[model samples]
Target: MHLLVCGGTGCRASASDSITESLKERLQEHNLQDEVQVVMTGCFGFCEKGPIVKVLPDNTFYTEVSPEDTREIVEEHLVKGRQVDRLLYQAPEGGRVKDSKHMDFYKKQIRIALRNCGFIDPESIDEYIARDGYFALGTALNEMEPRQVIDQIKESGLRGRGGGGFPAGLKWEFASKNEADQKYVVCNADEGDPGAFMDRSILEGDPHAVLEAMAICGYATGADKGLIYIRAEYPLAIKRLKIAIEQAREYGMLGESIFDSPFNFDIQLRYGAGAFVCGEETALIHSMEGERGEPTFKPPFPAESGYLGKPTNVNNVETYANVPVIINKGADWFSQIGTEKSTGTKVFALAGKVNNVGLIEVPMGTTLREVIFEIGGGIKGGKKFKAVQTGGPSGGCLTEEHLDTPIDFDNLLAVGSMMGSGGMIVLDEDDCMVSVAKFFLEFTVEESCGKCAPCRVGNKRMYELLERITQGKAEKKDLQRLNNMCHVIADTSLCGLGQTAPSPVLSTMKNFWNEYVAHVEDQRCPAGSCKDLMRYEIIPENCVGCTACARKCPVGAITGERKQVHEIDQDKCIKCGACLEACKFDAVTIK
Candidate 1:
């Protein structure tokens, strides 16, 4: 029997480490420590119910397992051989789900890249090996030639899981064609999207998978060295990656003559300063080479010259995570899983407004409706679904009409969005589209490398236009100017950061034009999200005149005698909504 406790960063923040120790101590008290092994594994993807604990053999899964509950879990479930009904995941339809396999969240998920994540103790290389961890690398080194490996990847149709969705094999072939004496394989772990954590989770949970994949990539592209360009913000992931690399080297899985073959490959780590622009390939290479993290023109692509001017193939962490699986399962088998064009599953960080906010992986061609509704458990608090922002700040906001749209590189792009590192942020009806656009623009503006005038100047101008709209100070002509400027920036920007910086504005304007019109023409925020456009009024009938709101008003915006109706002084009203919170009668309402 085994007890698997979630050791992912999210769960750790919730004191899952204490829960692990408590469980072990309880097992020792019962003299069952040897009988039942306690293991701390990576993320389970179902972050909503973490910190989770799963019992092996019986397949009993527990949700929100606190350290205090560890006693009952060990007593009833471990020792008594009975399940803890209260701790089991409650199904939306009523019954308790015994295990993850039966849960709706995992029903649609196909965990290929996340295969070992929630299953093994990430710190243990032996546990990783037991699960066929380095089998793919061994196979690649022993059986397959360099060109054959590349061809298999091509046949699998595995596109890069990074924003670009470029063909992985084609990139390898490009790097291979270059006659550089020194070549490199770089894993882009600098995931800077607003809600994206796919790359970080993979590294934390399955670092070996990425290391093995990079070695495979090194062989395929004739690259002798690999570098992981990860952000310093990810301490846990960096720690696990360092451990995995050292273990791989110690075990002869990495270093010279791996599997007794002629291939000599090793991996090193490069720390990023969490610059969003560094997510781009050239910018990442530049950062790795001790230069300012700014993007340059791409005539000399990373494949031709990168990382101190060598042939370098750059693929993100999730992209590399899929490599070993493709090698283990035949290319044809992997290719047949998804749509004809995009053949493989994609990992997504499903965040915001959604009830089941967590990491999810689904086959390509899965509808947004299925992911948002079924897998995500619908919008929180039963609020009406408004939109979903895919591909981070750079990707566009998709609406209800696009719910049934198949999710793939081509399909998302066709609907004015991109599969950008798989950050899916769901929005509700209460969310203001205008504000959403402004928020993304603000992020883009702050993160801009300032390499080009279009991104530096144009995005600031666009942000100011949005600010005016939200403040009810913009005319209808400003809308036209904003629209035209979006095109100008997108067309003129030198790099992808500037090019896609206008996506949020363009998408919100396209999908929620009425919201923009309300903000502009009516001088009102439809969602009541913009503070400047909101007016708090007292409902005369609802106000009991107890002076609760008046006492709470910081700026003295309310005035009335006791036991009488109150009125707000609009001139003094700061729109702080303090009265709304202080009122017991619910008299204050935003208009």
Candidate 2:
């Protein structure tokens, strides 16, 4: 019997390591250590009920497993052969879900890229091998030629999971056509989206999968060396990747000749300073080469010249994670899973107002309604769903009307959004659309490389326009100016960063035009999110003259005698909501 514990970064932060040790101690006390092996695996994708524990053979899954609960898990579940009802995941409607297969969160998910995650102990190469880890590399080296491998990838129709949904096989073919004595394969692990962790979780849980895929890519593109450009912010992923690399080299999977074949491929690591612009290929290559992480014109694409001027092929971590699976299952089988154009599952970091916040993978053509409602368990606190921002800052905001829209490269683009790195942030009715646009613009403005004037100057001007509208200080003409500037920056920007920088503004203006007009013409914020547009008033009838509001006012904005009606000095009020919290009689209200 195996006791699988979630060791992903999220669980670790919640003290899953202590839980694992506690479980081991309990097993040792019962002298059942040998009988029941305790293994720490990667993320289970259900982060909402994390620090999870699953008992194999029976497939009994436990949610929010704390260190104190390990004793009960071992005693009742393991020793007595009974299940722990309290720890099991309770369904939204009623009964408890005993395992992941039955949970609504896992029902729609088809985890191809995240196959090994939550199943194997990541630190142990032996565990990885037992699960057919390096078998794809062996098959590629022994049976298939380089061209044949590339052809199979093309047949599978796997597109890049990074931001651009470029064909993976076509990229390899381009790199292969280039005659460079030294060629390279680069895995872009610099995931800088606001709510995205798809790449980080894959690296932390299944680091070897990426290494093996890079080696396979090296063979397909005639690249002898591979480099992984990952951010230094991801310490856990970095540690596991280093461990995986060392294990692969020691096991003869990465060094000189592999599987007794003459293909010599090895991988090295390059650290990024968490620059969002480096998510682009040319900027990433420039950063790897120790230059200012800025992008140049793309006539000489990374396929033709990259990383010290060699033929280099770049794909994100999630994109590479899908490679071995495509090799194992035939291209026909893989291609049959999703749509004809996008033939594979995509991993997404589902965050924001959703109840079941976590990492999710679903086949292409799945509707946004299904992912947001069924898989995500609807909005938190029963709030009305406002919008969902896909593709991070580069993508657009989708509304209720677009809920039934099929999620794919073409479909999302048709609706004014992109499938960028799979960051899905769900918003509720309480969220202000104009504020949301400004928030993303703030991030883009801060992270801009300043290489192009359109991104540098144009984005700042656009951000200022959003700021004025949100502050209830803009006229109706500013709305048209903001709209016109969005197209200008998008058309004239040097790289993807500048080109897509205006997406949030354009999307919100298109979808929530009334909200923007409210801020401008009425000088009011419908969502009450913008502080400058809100004013706190003391309701005369509701005030009991208890002086609680007066005592709690930080800036002395409210004043009243013990038994008289209280009055609010609007000039002194900061709109901090402190008076509202302090008033027990509900005297304060926002206008």
Ten contiguous residues minimizing lDDT sum, candidate 2: 42-51
| Candidate 1 minimal-lDDT segment of 10 residues | 42-51
- Give the TM-score comparing model 1 with the true structure, all chains together: 0.83
Q: Local error of candidate 1 at 360, Å?
A: 0.7
Whole-model lDDT values for every prediction: 0.92, 0.92
Candidate 1 residue-wise lDDT, 21-131, digit = tens: 999999999999999999999666566578889999877899988999999999998878889999999987989988777877665779999999889988889999999
TM-scores for the candidates: 0.83, 0.84
Q: What RMSD, rounded to one decimal, does every model reach?
A: 8.1, 8.0
**Backbone clashes in model 1:** 0
Quality of model 1 by C-alpha lDDT: 0.92
